[model samples]
Target: MTQQNKIRICVAGATGWAASALCKAIIKTPDIELVAAISRSNAGKNLSEVLSLDTEKNIPIFATVEEALQVPSDVFFEYTSPVIAKHHILSALRAQRQVIVGTSGLTDEDYASIEAAAHDSGRGVLAVGNFAISVVLLNRFAEMAARYMPHWEIIDYASDKKVDSPSGSTLELVSRLAKVGQPITTIPIQDTKGYPETRGAAINHTQVHSVRLPGYIVSLEAIFGMESEKLILRHEAGSSAEPYVNGALLAIRKVQLVKGFRRGLDSVMD
Candidate 1:
């Protein structure tokens, strides 16, 4: 594709572990262009310089999302922390740029506000908790199981360094299952004899347990049970960030096709 046909992108947290890999991919892709980046630590430097990417074009890096918005772009990729992810997304929408969100920890309240902003701005926002294809399949499969099975729970696993409990992928799964209906619990937490917390936290009316430890990148399990049978759907990610790059790229290309907010990669897969 020619330069005029390429999709311009500005990536927040461009120097982050996962975003950096995406930046490299963007530079190499024929139909996408990395126009600018946001990184407080590496601000005022070229993206190619910070990522050590060998490219002829000079991609400017800005310290703040406000500064990055001044540069013309088609999409703003939010890969920053939860504290500022919503703010950055709102700012991008207000700037009339489509958005692809990879940051986690946004609450339902946050999404409501984002949905309003996107509608007002007439732009689109695509939020994906985890961009791995297997995670997408897990979410779809879990939704189907929720319709047939009455009892279920979720287990979220991540590395110790990951601060978010009930990984974003698990939260997305919970949101999806909530549409089907709440899981049936034979014994309520309030009815438990003791140590009710051991049963796990209730999220969207489904019990969710989070485990943080070493030797795990990210993993999610949706367990469904009946009187004599049980079914488990699990998706695990490895150390590499490669799994997310393609999904993110697809979101960038398809986000403009939507007018408001959308969640999950599967929303655009079709």
Candidate 2:
């Protein structure tokens, strides 16, 4: 593709742990152009310098999404914290830019608002809780397992420093399984003999347990049980951010194909 025909993208957390890897990949990608970046600490600096890349492209960094939107980009990539993610996405839609969301911790209500904004603006918003292909398959497999098995629970594991509970992947899994069917609960939380909190939080009629530790990067497990047999499906992420780069790139490419909100990477994947 010619330089003028390339997909222009502005990434909100361009200097973050995962987004930095995506920014590097975007620079190397032939069909995508890194137009602008949003990083409060790295504002007024070039993205090439912040990422330490040997490229001649002059990608400016802005402290806010509103400032970055001034560069006339075609796509907005949100990888920042939950606190500002919704506001950034809405701002992007109002700015007439399609969006690909990589931030987690947004509730269903948050998505509803984004969906409405995208509809009014006639822009597409693809929100992915987890961008790893393995996690995508995990969600698909867990949905399939939910059809056969009636009892299941989710175990979410992440780094100790990560603030989000249950992880975004876990939330996505819960939402997916809810569409399949609500898991069978034999003992209601109210009827529990001991502390009801031990049963974990009930989200969308499914029990979810979150574990924050030092060793884990991000791991999700779905355990399904029927009378005598049990099936466990799990997806774990490594130390590197490479697993998410390709999936995110795909989202950036396909987000404009639709006019509303899409929830998963699998939504655009064949």
**Highest lDDT, which number?**
2
Task: At residue 231, give the lDDT of candidate 2.
Answer: 96
Clashes of each: 0, 0
Angstrom error at residue 60, model 2: 0.7
- Give the alpha-carbon lDDT of every model: 0.92, 0.93
TM-score versus the correct structure, for each prediction: 0.98, 0.99
Per-residue lDDT of candidate 1, residues 149-219 (tens digit):
89999999999999878777888899999999989999888999979999999998999999999998899
Error of 1 at 11 (Å): 0.4
Task: For candidate 2, write residues 241-263 as lDDT tens digits.
Answer: 99999999999888869689889
Error of 2 at 11 (Å): 0.2
Q: After superposition, how far is residue 145 of candidate 1 from its true place, in Å?
A: 0.6
